[model samples]
Target chain A: MSTLISLIVSGCATGAIYALVAIGFTLLWQTSQTINFAQGEFVMLPAFFMLAGMNMGMPFWLAILVGTAISVAILGAAFKRALVDPMLRHGALPLAIATMALSIMMKEGVKEFYGAEAQPFPSLIPAIDLHFLGATISTQSLGLLAVGVAAVLALQYLLNSTSVGRQMQATAQNPNVARILGIPVERMVMYSFIINAILVSVASVLVTPLYLAKFSSGETLGLAAFIAAIVGGFNQVRGAILGGILLGITDNLAATYISTQYRSAVPLALLIAVILFRPQGLLGTAEERTV
Target chain B: MSITRKVSRLAVLTLAAGFMAAPVLAQPIHLEDVAELSGGGATVGTNFKNGADLAIAEINAKGGILGHKIEITHADSQSNPGVARALVQKALDNNPYVLLGPGYSGSVKVTESLAAKAGIANIMGGEAAELTQTGNEYVFRTSFGQQSTMPKVARYIAEEIKAKTVAVVWVNNDFGKGGRDVINAEFAKRGIKVVADLSTEAGQVDFAADVLKVKNAAPDAVFVYLNEDESARALKELKRQGVTVPLIGETTLTGQKVIDLAGGAAEGALAHVGLTTDAPIPAVQEFRKNFAAKYNYVPDHNGIKGYLAIYVIKAVTEKMGKVDPANFAKTLHGMTIRAKDEPGILMDVTYDEHGDIDRQGFLVEVKDGKQVVKTILPKMVP
Candidate 1:
């Protein structure tokens, strides 16, 4: 019982990290039909930026702030204006291709400049373990869980209650009609990109202590979240959140109960099953072609 | 033809033959190094390159190898086996006398046969046990194979710690998997039970699930065998989980790079190292100082492997009394190079017919961010 509880607790913590990144994926897919393939690399870069800032005598939180600011200015606003706008003009496929190229560039560029070593980052929470309900949980895990849940709730509120979000939803549903209704469709996409950046930045800071800041770390980190978003539902935020948690727990349980060698295989098996049986995902509704 | 033109053509022909025949008159030795200078294996490759370059600088200053200044052409493998094979082909195209490189075992497995076919010696830093098992005579290792290293570690766990149950955490790659298999066999032979065996991905970030599983197992000790960065993350996660079991591992687990990344978590971890900068020998201390001075970072086991590859070429050539590429592998087989004779070799090393190496090693414990030697295991032969 204790072992099961420990696995669930740790797995959920891992899932929360993945969910934070999946939100960005779901948001972009909904707003502009854009899939940022560089999502994982984006998370990795800002952590290094924060490390550079800390090296230059800034506190950890201040370094993170500076890093987040730079990401907003460049990866968010400037990226949309320069590359995303031009690429999306052709279609989402072109934007996806562009983001894939951007991922490689970010990986290689960081490897060239920052050196290919894992730099240790300061942990956000203390390294204290507390026992609760017959299970051992680290303070760091609890801290990260709280932050991730809080961020998700805040994002959910923003999308459900705010006028900007309503307009964004209007643009997502029918960009032509939203523009006709004076919704500023371009600005809605811009807001989606900015929000994606902020979410990844938060995710980056939360996970860097465990992953450390390495150039190749993003490859797996991004891939895991992408799977979560797809398995949960590409079009719905709640589906993505559930998908992340489900994959996380299943992964741990598989490792513990099944063969360790086949632990990764089990989640992949689930992914294939979902794709085959329910392409619309667990919580998603089947959509009809309107053409 | 005019008599003057005929005589000039004759003179030019004779001069060209002389230039080809008297190649020994040239002051430089042509060598090629293809290594993983960027990507996943970048840290290993960079350290190896720096170590090789340092040895070259020192040797050139001391009147060169057999009176020929060593000149090495370095290429990047990018950590991909295919890229490494392509680079090896390119290096062989130059018809280099020796090939050095590709610290990655997968790269070495693909590239070593090329050098063997070309009759050029390849000295690499790959630690996978199966790398040299394919009967590739031209490939030589600067570190011990898992086959050689695991038995010693197994003996330690059974006798020293006397642990009946053990847990093994390994990266699911050629290097880690190879080591894990060897250690498992060793443990089985020694009648030790493997309670939990956790396999991880190469660049996996979260170790919470892995750690929790290990904690649930509640083994007497844990064996970690992963790449440098992943090892650090596992250590950090293990510390955070407050697992009080002693950690034991091979080279990468307690490496200087891992220590730097794991911060305080690496302390008290024990590892069996084939080559470490922390050896008590004066020559090793000097290597540590020179490497730190040159690269401004403490050298890891891979660096020592790289430095020795260059020194081995010199030692073998000098002993053979000629720079003979065709006879290089044959000469190295069943040959022993003594540290007393050539201090650059660092330790007395012998190479068998299969290209495997035997030399002194150390069991060290990480103390205060340093690998403090616990005991020096004597060379396998003497």
Candidate 2:
């Protein structure tokens, strides 16, 4: 049915966004054994910066590029140095609480500066509607899908082919061993944070037009993406992508068939089911701890 | 001369000086604005303050009420109910003649009781129907309540649009749920069947499923009880799903944010509004011009109500000559100022016994990228 197809298309779009967030979670957790709870804010704040750049008379593309670059290079590095690296030594709970505090600060900071008006981001792609397989797709949705898949492919290529990517992987697998092998483990962890920032920023740029760049945009987006990461397999890259897509589709299908009143509960239900049935997730490897 | 004679002379000189400097000694009439300045509701709170500020500035420029300068002090509520109560207490400590706003209905409901207990009149645009019905004599709403606005929407849908079956999708919140209850009750009275009633959580972004549900029901029209953000997203989803049926939303849909966020999809979407700025009324025209000049942006319904709240207070107090809290409340209740009589208000404002405004609700549709008046319903005074 057209309804089913429509739900699938929208589900895919939403899923792609969640996948980016899940990847951010997986990247940092793998490299540094830390979770950035402010991952959603990472997506949200950059869209505002991009808009700020555009408002300052920069062309749209240039602003987006510069905004994304700055977010990745400067803000990401500063966040790791100030919050993550400093508090990470205190333990996971402290770093998580710090990230939560960071999220609140980012939200309030943007709100104070930009005001609470839900400013719409201009569509990166044309608004032309393309219909295929009984579903209508906007060019913007297509852009999101393209970017999501391309980022995933590029990340996979880097992890497998490049020397630096292998070094980073080796550091994530066993930091002590990688350090003994002369690989810079700390630098890899920092690189992971930078990459995390870039992934979420890309998601923000692609999705901000559909949902305007506003203060509270991060709350639901971050929560849902965090849920997706947990449900998919927090440690596996492909699992995070699969988790995002599945959560998105499940949300839409449940909303369509069951009830909108209970749609919000579906993601949590999925999380619970995954936790009960398979503690390590569908694609996650169970870690063997040596005492 | 004796010491008593000198003291008497000093007392007489002081008394004479006090009498001579009476104009300078008189206290300025102060109104306190308790607003959500730094939180979720700050967008409207700040705009509402700006509107009130404009009115205050104009009033002062014309020598103020009863030759007394009007001063307004703003206390940020932070959009929390507890904070709103604390701000009202702080405002009361300063002994303001009137308490202005706390943006949303929840905060208004919370602080109105405190305002009443302190004998300070509260003027706000919080449209919750029960705000006045709680026997809080100090609370007066400048905006139309759901009881007044929703019934007219029902009548418009049934009588004018001739929609037999209506589908309802509302955000799951106080405002949206409150709107839903009223719309259902009003529709039941008019004998229109509500086919599907769906509600999504407050911050929900994806409406594809909700829209598809409406599409399946195939109602003659869809009525959305949602805020500006949710309304924009839902309307867009409705369009993409190719459901061409008429989409009517609550008054919040008339906001410019809906138009800006929804873009082309917002076209032809009808909404209930208190008054149209383009209604060929000089007062509205003047307000539009002055607001744009002052704030560098067009004023919405919230801003207009905020602007009018101050003027209503001024008009009432000016007639009474002195600012007495008890007298002010009584005077406002007894007053019946229509659009034709008042230069500030665009709609007829007659406060009922509960202090809810008895006014006509205007129906507007987005036409050619702007809100164009579709029709005006006759006033149904409650």
Worst 10 residues of 2 chain B by lDDT: B36-45
Model 1, C-alpha of B308: deviation from truth (Å): 1.2
lDDT of 1 by residue, A158-272 (tens): 7788999888888888899999999999999899889888888888888888777888778877877888887888887777778888888888888778866777787789888
Q: How far out, in Å, is residue B31 in model 2?
A: 3.5
lDDT of 1 by residue, B211-307 (tens): 8888878999999998888888899889877888889999888899999999999999999999999899999999989999998889899889889
When summed lDDT is taken over every stretch of 10 residues in candidate 1 chain B, the lowest stretch is B19-28
Put down candidate 2 lDDT per residue, B1-382, tens digits, no spaces.
9999999999999999998977654568999999866555655687788889888898889888777888999877876778998888999888888889987777887788888988888998687667777888788888888877887788878997899999999877656677889899988988899999998876688888888788889999999877667788988888887889888876777567678788888999888888556555677888889988998777677777778888888878877888776788878885788666556666667887778876766788898778887777666753
Shift in Å, residue B272, candidate 2: 2.3
Residue pairs with clashing backbones, model 1 = none
Best by lDDT: 1
- Chain B, candidate 2: TM-score: 0.89
Error in Å for residue A124 of model 1: 2.1
RMSD of 2: 3.6
Q: Cα RMSD to native, each candidate?
A: 4.2, 3.6
Q: TM-score for chain A of every candidate model? A: 0.95, 0.95
Off by over 4 Å in 1: A285-291, B1-27, B61-63
DockQ of predicted model 1: 0.55
Off by over 4 Å in 2: A288-291, B1-22, B36-42, B71-95, B338-342, B346-348, B378-382
